[model samples]
Target: MNAPVDIAKMLQPRPVPAAMLDALKARFGERCSTAQAVREQHGRDESPFEVPPPEAVVFAESTTDVADAVKLASQYEVPVIAYGTGSSLEGHLLAVQGGISIDVSRMNQVLRINDEDLTVTVQPGVTRNQLNNAIRHTGLFFPIDPGADASIGGMAATRASGTNAVRYGTMRENVLALEVVTASGEVLRTGTRAKKSSAGYDLTRLMVGSEGTLGILTEVTVKLYPQPESVSAAICHFPSIDAAVKTTIAIIQLGVPIARCELLDANAVRYVNNHDKLSLRPAPMLLMEFHGSAAGVAEQAQTVQEVARDHGGEDFQWATTPEERTRLWTARHRAYFAGMSSNPGCRTVTTDTCVPISRLASCIDKAVTEADEAGLPYYIVGHVGDGNFHIAYMIDPGKPEQRVLAEQLNDQLVHHALSLEGTCTGEHGIGLHKQGFLVDEAGAATVEMMRLLKRALDPKNILNPGKIFAL
Candidate 1:
């Protein structure tokens, strides 16, 4: 493993020449700033390492503004880091190349909601919570709920997915089209509103998870699902981890269309109990939700209950009321943050691996055992139904050796997952953190093909550079 450098350093802002700063000030006025506070906010993402910030932050208020900034950036030969909700888990927003930071928050607006077509067109800065609140009265909802109130563009860039992913699928599936500003400042639309097509190259799909490298996603069109007719959620306790894994695998094999099937280890349960102020037992637990018509949900719940019973699972304490369900899901969504709160003055290091239903148990079993042996302070949680899991490590930043060990263990977990014909990342795209593993996961030829495509789209490397690829 590479020797650990200081990964927790805050982003440092680069200084632009007076001529450039004056030009930017003339161009954007109050929207552009060289102040340290603003630059700091624009520089770092939610990732571990912090690097140099851009010379200035330019708040672009519209797609045209973004195109203008890109044109200026192309002329200046400077880095242009697209900023969204600042919730990325990788070092995606770091201005490693040093130039201008395009803060997209000002551009937030819902362009269109085609109820008949069941899709929404939104600007890059519109957040998930904001979008949901806007459409709350419409009876249709966007279902890709990543933990944070992340921007749609950022979520698309990262290819984020969460609890609902088991039911609604990830950005890769929901994203129908994108309006993008290329490296050369050309504004183009990739895909049509059609649900399915075999017409041309899959540019829409390609741009969905590009992490703002090939192009800056200015606007996005995503499919929406009709609100669930009947929604029911519950918590199920298991006697052991093995029992929980076995039951999860059984649910998948039985083909139950559960909306969410998440596993929370005893440690994670303890974290939530402390953070959310709940008094639940600290055992391996499952937080599940089922959606459908009343009769269908009832039948599915009954079958699930039976399977749980056979696997040493406990009672299903249901949450029927909207408030109760919201409270429950809110707790689940902040499970990792809750884990972090359990340790004062420490940050979280997350590791995720996904495998097939047949190998899920083996992958998680070994990971837990390895974490235990390493004496790591971490909590295990996951969307277990899809055979994917995450380990949230609350590591002390003062200790570099420990962080290296954590990374090594994570590498091993990825190796194990890949051994089962799984992926290193189930939802999180191959940002800077996962770049090295991409080659091993997708062989040399495939990696070469990916590089060629990236080159074709972003020959200048002015978009999010040094992400996924070494260049």
Candidate 2:
């Protein structure tokens, strides 16, 4: 069972020596901020946890700035948390161990664009949308969208994936190389632009999902895909979530090559309808997209529609124009906010369990049953093509019992996924929230190995301390 997080016990803020603060202020001048507002902003993320803020915030404008700030933290034996757009939902940015935050938003820049090779090098602060806009004219796009306009650095750090991952793969596959500032404040580079390599350690990947525990990502190089010549988006209504899930499973099993296959239960659809001001049918639905040549796109759409029809799907609708497609997806991406809005002053305990395609239906069915029986306000949505989905349980923060019930539901969901040979978290990394689940998924020995790696690299244990697993 999942235990509630105790803020008091976890707020073991190590004293940030005044000398270190003075040193950082002297080095960075106005860029170093000790303002409570700035530190509070950097300390919390989208996660529900509320802990004390970091002692200081450093606005890093370049790799050199990050390195120097980290150097001071390393010298002072204080935790250094890397801050991006703070869109992470796993509490990855909280400064539980009190130190300083190095905000990378100022480092926004697309350093190099190799349109010929289909790769781009960018500073950590560049957002996914910004990256796509910068390369749109080159007929290329980065497809690893994590729903949020997350910073490139944060995405790389969390090894994020989204609707596009079913075809384009996650950050682990798209990211080619990184310029990192290590625990000791040394610059390290990993991987190359070449497609494949037999390089020694695969350090690039090792750092990808470390969640800022090992090093700080300063620059990232990621592979890009050509813009689809022919694209089509469609939605189909199903009698129940079961029907929609079965359709998705059939599509994937038959190798339909759907670019994006998303599911939104009746609750999710209603919330989105209210928030986006669209009168979509409040039923379990599948929002799908096809990308390829004209003939190829048509064929894929036909196959998927046939599959849906066999599974009791109806009201298949297409969004033909680019603007229409954008509007639909924009609504989908805002589903989380929509859910929150529905419950005025509520926080959510969201599950990121991902099972194999075969077990998705069973996994989702049991989760839905339990959530409904619990009598809690909840919504279900997912990138179901790849067997990943989210069930967000909205709970009033003022009610302790509601939080407990939500956590219980999440605990059961995660354990069931693990039992079915799935992951506790598919895209979200093990921040403070999922440490227990990580241990349950990866055995004690395996977790110990991870701890060893963390110790080997960060001997001081000052980089994003109290995350993943306590050292």
Candidate 3:
């Protein structure tokens, strides 16, 4: 069932002018790599979609490099795709249109830490864990954890949110400012160190989740949180999905201020236990964390426990020690890889949706039922506290039927969530996978407006062409 790939046809066979490549090589010297290995490496990501590699890969070390490369690309009308760590689940880094990829991984630097301002300015190549480690001594930590050690630039590009988003918010809320290299090769600084401002335009936000479609992010300044005095994590098993959903609803409605509240369906939990070698029960489970003063965390845990009990939750295990908490969350973060392990030699279509908190139960219940009836091997893990859940469908990529079915199931889930006033994508940006759904989620008029904005900024469409939406 392995399908033939028409890479050239898919890429539409766009030719990169040789003069531009020579100029880039001359300007960047050894940093400009036209090697096949480098092109292949920068062309694809964790996404399942396959595409031809870019014509060339430019390793950019600073904002000046990015601007220079972009300026040259603009001269040749060549598409420019920015590359970070390439951990993005969507095909955000793919050179689908046959262009050049500007890699910023070498730009890893912690530019500044204004501890008094509760903010840190960092290069785009800095990963979330890296930032936290760099600032750990400051007693302040960046809270956006998207499971993978994704670069800050990529995280901001995708507007990623993870377990902690329910409390501290996503890149949208945490990011304070940005240094962006526009399509015209001009550097624009958006936002300010000041917390609140009545600026002319919220350009920083406009670029935060632009997915490299609008411009390239060189530096990002993000708000950081003071380490909580007390932090506690808990695991609870539920008799059924109904009980788990109800407990989540009640917890959120009660305003528990839980730092992290994640749901692992029975199947997902079983896979996690197998992968992590833990002795957890094989049932739908909720992993939660509370951060506050010792007394406050204790009170929050007690309230959640009471709510869980009222909703038929059992096996309430609390992990207060650092070691225990790390072990617990490590298992949780490994859920994606663990689930993939359950089905060897299969590709995963990891999709997510966010709904109104009140409708979380209905949306998840319907999705689970349909997936069960479809008999697809899948796992469901969610940041249910924020009404965002992920369904990763393990599909035999060689089989077209499995891929089609997985997409159909995803479409159903997305349409259902949209019907319930939810978004097609919660955290993962609209890369190649979710392009069609973008217009569906946002009306034709809205998407057209977005296109207008894109045309205005990247008039030549040389910036990550054929992403978000098509002209």
Candidate 4:
């Protein structure tokens, strides 16, 4: 392990500016809260990191409200952190530098849906499930599914992708435009509904994964897809992780156009079974889905089944009905919560890494071996179709040593992925947890260029201050 670095100082909370508080309260009235409960709730995220809460919370109902809050914060030079449903795995919403949290949950609205053009414009607070439900009757669906019913704005900010990302791509591809409020409280529109554009700078792509540091997204426009006429989902068990990964590689290499291919280690299966109360085989497993016409779906499934059998996979458990498919996916999406329930009151420190498709088997094998040797309580799951996976280290938060061990394990795994030409983060962005890894992955020069852009765009550093990189 590398030498321990002192990060406590960096996590220290800054004092709330009195003038900023008064100004916000005056402008937002009851919508602005400094109450203890509200502040506590806004301070941290779903991650295991404990942090000081924001000094205040502003429930923004429109773009104007967000702009007003940011303008007030900029005047005081106080940090402005954007908050959604608080589902982020990293410490993206932590008030490390105390400031105001602009909660956009009230901004949930489906502004527009261009069915013919296959695009939908929504307020930042709109959840992915909500967007899909609103468009379900139109025979169109938003393909990105990051498990948690996370806000679309949050997903875009993190550039999240999921099981379907192998085919539909991540937020980077789906998001077509954004209406963002800059640090200075000015609104900037990026991109358009047009499918492709080589126009000027790709600002939409830049803001999609900026993690709210560059600007606060008030609106997002994303691509939608026509629902497949026939859908099939299945779960197949593998003799070993190696076999499971190899099957996934073969399927991807063969270009199967599989919609979803998720992997769960034996440990993960056991925990989910105990927590979700379903009897799944205690082995490396793959939860797959096929989206196409009936004949095409059948052909794709048969091909994947053959590939899996070649890798020593067992008979598949099929979910042919929509209800059955939903149940199976619900169990998969709740894997993190099930992992948390493994040890009541235990917190999880998670790490994700994505390597080239060919190197995934070797990368995961090393991680599993090292983690088992450490004997730390954990769960492993992956979007293996795209070579991205996560390990959740279940640690008793009261034990400082356990947290230390978990961080060490995560660091080792990230460095291992980097050695294999992989990225430190796949879908999850560089929040507080992966700041160090960002430098290692992107190199000093590239990070400096990013810093220059951040400074040029947000001169006061009030937009999510102390994130992505230090000023």
Model 3 TM-score is 0.97
Q: Write the per-residue lDDT of candidate 2 for residues 1-471, one digit (tens) a residue.
A: 768666667777888899999999999999999998988889888888888899999999999999999999999899999999999988899998999999999999999999999999999999999999999999999999889999999999999999999999999999999999999999999999999999698999999999999999999999999999999999999999999999999999999989999999999999999999989999999999999999999999999999999999999999989999999999999999999998899998887989999999999999999999999999999999999999899999999899889888988999999999999999887798889999899999999999999999999999999999988
lDDT of 4 by residue, 148-254 (tens): 99999999999999889999999999999999999999998999999999999999999999999999999999999999999999999999999999999999999
Clashing pairs in 4: none
Model 3 lDDT per residue over 1-471, tens place? 112222344465457999998999999999999999999999888888888899999999999999999999898899999999999887888887888999999999999999998999999999989999999999999999989899999999999999999999999999989999999999989999999999698999899899999999999999999999999999999999878989999999999999999999999988988999998999999999999999999999999999999999999999989999999899999998898888899999889999999999999999999999888899999999999999999999889888888888888998899999999899998887787788788999999999999999999899998778777
Clashing pairs in 3: none
Error of 4 at 467 (Å): 1.1
Q: What is every candidate's alpha-carbon RMSD to the true fold?
A: 2.1, 0.7, 2.4, 1.1
lDDT of each: 0.84, 0.94, 0.91, 0.91
Q: Model 2 segments beyond 4 Å from truth?
A: none
Predicted structure 4, TM vs. truth: 0.98
Which regions of candidate 3 are displaced past 4 Å?
Answer: 1-10
Ranking by TM-score: 2, 4, 3, 1
lDDT of 1 by residue, 1-471 (tens): 422333343233333557777777888899989888899888887666757667799999988889988887776666688999888776788876677889999778999999889999999899999998888778899988877889999999888888888888989999999999999899999888899999889998888888888899999999988888998988899998888999989998899999999999999889898999988789999999999999988888999999999999996798889999888788888887887788987767786878888898889989989989999898888988888799877778898777788887888888888989999888766676777678889988888898888788777667776677755
Highest-scoring model, lDDT:
2
Q: Give the CA lDDT, 0 to 100, for residue 24 in model 4.
A: 86
TM-score of each: 0.96, 0.99, 0.97, 0.98
- Native-referenced Cα lDDT, model 2: 0.94
